[model samples]
Each structure stands twice: as structure tokens, then as C-alpha cells.
Target: MTLRLQPVRLASGNDDSEAQLVFAGNALVAVLTHLAEHHDGEAGRWFMEAWFGPGYVLNRPTFASLDKAQDWILERLAEV
Candidate 1:
């Protein structure tokens, strides 16, 4: 079972803007984080508007290492 991992671009960059989302997706699901850290306005914005919902606020788990990143992605699979 090969996972088709693809990078996710949060926005088109040309100037000083928030960094791209440090997240990826496979055929089954996509996992995301606030990028390098949490409380990231842009990342949080994308999660709320795109994946989760207006009222949903995902904050507890964040990617810190390679293993954690993978876990984060798997954890979000249920939502997808």
C-alpha cells in the first residue's frame, strides 16, 4: 500500500506572507498543521474554513518531528 503523499500549498506567494502549510495528503486522507508551530493564523484559517468548520478549533496536536507529523495526518483521517 503505497501512500500518495503530496505537498499542500496554502496560498500563492510573491511577497511577505505566511509560509505554506507543512502538510501532505494521500489517497485516503490529508493531514495538516499550523506549520512549524501552532496559533498560525493562516494555517488555522485554512483548517477552519476548508477542512473542519466555522465552529471547530483544532489545536492540541502539532507536528514537531517526523513521527509526530505522520501521526497528525493519520489522526485527521477520521474527519475526512
Candidate 2:
């Protein structure tokens, strides 16, 4: 399977607007938001804002980078 990421700005009503739309092939699989400075220790991490399809539910909500997030997403996708 192929995974793609599209940069996006979300109207999340907070400083955490910078995000990425994660797609598995042509299907959107997840939305990952960048944690804002207000998040303190968690700031600058990637947060799983949303997920779709089977086996996408997150056991961990934060990732150190988009690559890590995608790795986790791919693992879940593969499980289905």
C-alpha cells in the first residue's frame, strides 16, 4: 500500500491549526495536528486528531514526528 500526506490548516479554534491529511492510496486515513506551544511538554509533537476505516483507533495519540505517525497508521492499516 502507498501512503501520502497533504499539508493542511485546520480551523481547530486553537493554535494547533497546522496539520496533515494522511491518505492511504486515494482514501483519507487520518488527520494529524501539530501540538501548539500551550501544550507545554507535549508541544511540537504530532497528535492524532482523527482517523478513519477499520483498525485506525489510536492507542497512543502523540508522535514525535509525522513519519512516526504514518508508520503507526500503516501498521494499523496492514492489520485489517
Candidate number achieving the greatest TM-score relative to the actual structure: 2
TM-score for candidate 1, residues paired by index? 0.33
Whole-model lDDT, model 2 = 0.89
Residue 39 C-alpha lDDT in model 1: 45
Per-residue C-alpha lDDT of model 1 across residues 1-80, encoded as one tens digit per residue: 22343444455343222322333332333334334234455333323213331234455343444355555445555455
- lDDT by candidate, in order shown: 0.38, 0.89
Work out candidate 2's RMSD over C-alphas: 1.4
Candidate 2 residue-wise lDDT, 2-34, digit = tens: 789999999989999999999998999898999
Model 1 RMSD to the real structure?
A: 7.0
Report clashes for each candidate as comma-separated counts: 0, 0
Local error of candidate 1 at residue 57 (angstroms): 7.6
TM-score of each predicted structure versus truth? 0.33, 0.91
